[model samples]
Target: MNDRKPNLRSVRELTPALEFCTIHGYRRAYRVAGSGPALLLIHGIGDNSTTWSTVQSQLAQRFTVVAPDLLGHGQSDKPRADYSVAAYANGMRDLLGVLDIEKVTVVGHSLGGGVAMQFAYQFPQLVDRLILIGAGGVTKDVNIALRVASLPMGGEALSLLRLPLVLPSVQAIGAVAGKLLGTTALGRDLPNALRILRDLPEPTATSAFTRTLRAVVDWRGQVVTMLDRCYLTESVPVQLIWGERDAVIPVSHARMAHAAMPGSQLEIFERSGHFPFHDDPDRFVEVVQRFIDSTEPAEYDQTALRQLLRTGVRERAISGTVDTKVAVLDAMGTDERSAT
Candidate 1:
């Protein structure tokens, strides 16, 4: 059994104040560093705010970076509660409201990508720009690995795999079992699952992951997609960063998304995998910084929201469909409760 401790050199940037706040009575942890336009870095499932450790500080240098450990991950309180994308999105909005932050560049990775989109969709007024890193909500095609993890009894198995004492042996046995299984779906994803579990060896976090997984995925694949409602983006700029070899959510999703979003920029990390930012931190930083510098943040308006909602039907009459910047203002009457 490999009992090696995970190399966390990349995630040691919590030097910034690790703050705590309560949202809907659930205590959540977050790290805010640097100062500039607000940048909210949302991590993926089975992961926490530390997932952005590699790039958060660098981004902080230019932008106010706020990295939160979502409700059921990291140092945040994990309650047996709703793990749906909408719920997570709403939570994000409440967190920002607690801080009095009105707008931000919402950057999300993997499951975080789904959350980012939902946040943008649910509150286009709060997002200045939408950045998706190997995001999951653009398509229904997800790795069989996550789909299986979201199934019945899968949560129990996931918890066992992530147990601190059992993980090393589990990884060893899983590796051997994977070898015996050949090139099967389990073979491909078991290694990833084992690696992730080894890094995140907390039962509560693992449980939250499984619950979050079941929320967005199923045996068939991802259950939610952003394509149908992309037109809501309207004037907000969208940028996509994807690893060429992403196995969790194929890079094809990025390609398809870029095509759908005519002007949106897509940067493919040549040799990267699911965690492109981790795989090539320098490039990841470079691309995102450039994106922030070159683009303008989106501002929300009820009149615009009302107008943007009509774009699809309007575009169909002329061209096709489109997207939003999530910023909640008093100008948007009657939507205050929903936005906040």
Candidate 2:
């Protein structure tokens, strides 16, 4: 048997300190560590760079990991401005440019997954690979809670989060529920939900969260989907991971996305929930590292992308390989292509 001493340092100790930079006149906070191929980690809505704390340092051992708090979250500037997926994609490009980094293997979770896909679509030359975890922008079906939050007066309703003793009371309840239902999806997801609720007490954060939520979600469900353009990722290495019990963005979406994008890899955590990384970080890191080691970084070919765009994905239909369900869904909504 192989014997090795485990590194006993805390995750906070292993993680690099937050760094600041000015991009488009807004202060952005990010954590950077190690020196190798760049890996950009984008967190979900209502989350900050710290959400990746469990796996960031481990990934850093083999890659230059960059985790950023998207504008309006964490300590970043919360301006009354655009938070659309396309706009957030632009912000990522600008931030990377300011840091003098050219290309990255983009890894996104939840809402951040939408932004990562947009980034790859808008700036293909800057992306090496795409990794999505419990990502949005896959289907119109989302959690009813997100749909409710996107409704009118949703921002006003969030004021209830600020009531005195609300946070502590919820935390107490969550602690007890977590023990009783530890293996259930609700229990697996409660801690992260509580973390998000904790941030809602701040007026600016609440406002930013509401605006960001409404940008991609609505009372009906998700307003954006990348399935129509998923064919373009044929030239990019793609890996998708999801928890089988994911309540926020159903696991079926992962299977659907894998079907839409050819040659993509998919992994499902049997006992996890929305946050697979938090649920099984060691496996998460192993899967990521193995994928990175096995695949070559995609080289963006502008001429090829132009040709693909010109021809459109209709060729898949002629080849009898098109997913009819995806086609029907694509036809249902007008794709709001990213600008910039």
Candidate 3:
């Protein structure tokens, strides 16, 4: 595996130029390349489309890759309308519709992963395959930092990032920490995390980040989960990728999601952190290409989906599962204590 970290400058140079479109009267920025099947890439919270810069070119060679900056992140307009996962899904749909693209293999990372799942749930007709990398919305377990940031004062706290010297101090600390814990997940992901922090200094970006984070996370952990609807993905090709040492979202969520979603594939990167694609772009690209080549694009069947929803998930399909039960209960405004 190539352990070389991505050079942002070079990656940006190789990626397609940013394109703009108006969705719901807000300007949305995205990049597109190649011309085969479509691939829609969504970046996580506090991240832009540039997160996929390393693999975008390679993926674009074989597929029409489209990477968009969510409304609250990157170059997109950070309107205070809505930052919910479902809202982001709607934004993606509108963006794709404007691009004249009918369907795509949706790839999402971290918070983007939650949006991707929401996309699949809200607009099943648009997704050909689902690829989630260290995705959120798996379980309540998340990095404590996120949990804390989701608190009410989190937005106010972010204002401190904009104070003089604070950003530089954080960067310096991250540099030192990177060298000290070079082999750990935090060390490996510090650069990307720093990049995200730099974006937070901006008030609009900070507000967007806070709202987005609070939508799927809280003082406890992640507030949203996809396990209850994992069974509904039975007709779509699903792939879960995670870093074994991911400090943001635990890799155990991958196993639980894999169990809940029948026939889904999971790939764990041994030496990676939160950004598996960045940690090993070569393998990430290979894995994605191989998965696409091996599996058939999902054919949306309204009848089948209706029947499945009406009949509900089979007991055998999700039997012997604790995660599903917890998710079901959580969805119904209850906790594990009441569930048990």
Candidate 4:
């Protein structure tokens, strides 16, 4: 029941109509348009909700689209806080509560996909449908460049990229180097380093990015995996989308995740890369529309959740206690000594 009005604009508009909300002392900014069942769009690391620019309006025709700039990125306030997936999930829940929107069809890209999965895990009742695009939480095999950036020494190196004073000079040099090298991987090591450099010039954004990246990634590729817990979403409708030409996180992850969850749907964009939604916005929107139209929203059981929690207790009872194990060992020792 927040009386404050939300700032909104259509995709057809030139200047963006961004909205702001103060949630628990943090200034959270988001954009909302159209109306129907609520839809939450989450952006990836180092990127904001602007990444959803291509498809947001088109989808808004049928659904109420709520795309927020995650805390520590874009217009949102960046504070020294826990940047873990669980923390983000809780934040999303709180944001929705503040807006008074109960249920949503959650759509996330890359790092946002990890957050979306964690949200569903933490608050299954709030999630109606789940969609992941080029998600990072399904596999261990991430690009080596990202893994390297997760190291302790990587922070010092990354700081140079955030020097706003020197960015113009760097861009000038980069432009000169680019013409000679063309669009090559070495020209821009990560999938979107050049874009990140341009978009996220603030020191706070850089710091948040570094902290966020290290939490889920390490020198050994991605440290977080949703493969083990994907079964929990069995009752909920899940969709996996990936670019066939994706070099950042590889389409293999989508395949693996799709295989792990037999009930989920998989769509591969043949001519797309890391950002498939951008590669073919119309097709992406069409696919999402079709999926939403075809599937029914999830109806989770509260009793099943309690049952799932109680399983460990039953398992422990079957396995016996620490005292029982010690007692058995003592009895074996007694029998052996007596026989000897």
TM-scores of the models, in the order given: 0.81, 0.90, 0.91, 0.81
Clash count per candidate: 15, 0, 0, 0
- Report the lDDT tens digits of candidate 2 across residue range 1-340: 7465553445565566799998878999999876679999999999999999899888877778899999989989999999999989999999899888999999999999999999999999999999999999977889998999899988888877788987788888988887897878777888898888888879999999999999889987888788778888989999999999888998878877777776899999999999999999999999999999999999989899999888776534321225645544453355442223
**Predicted candidate 3 versus true structure: per-residue lDDT over 297-326, tens digit per residue:** 999999999988887756567533687556
Ranking by TM-score: 3, 2, 4, 1
Better of 2 and 4 by lDDT: 2
User: lDDT for each of the candidates?
Assistant: 0.76, 0.86, 0.86, 0.77
For model 3, name the residue pairs that clash: none
Q: Where does model 2 exceed 4 Å of error? A: 1-14, 315-340
Poorly placed runs, candidate 3 (over 4 Å): 1-14, 319-340
Please report the TM-score between candidate 1 and the true structure.
0.81
lDDT of 1: 0.76
User: RMSD to native for every prediction?
Assistant: 9.4, 3.9, 5.8, 11.1
Best by lDDT: 2
Ranking by lDDT: 2, 3, 4, 1
Q: Residues 294-328, candidate 1, lDDT per residue (tens digit)?
A: 98888777897787676552333212223221111
Tens-digit lDDT string for candidate 4 (44-83): 8888888888988888877888999998888899998878
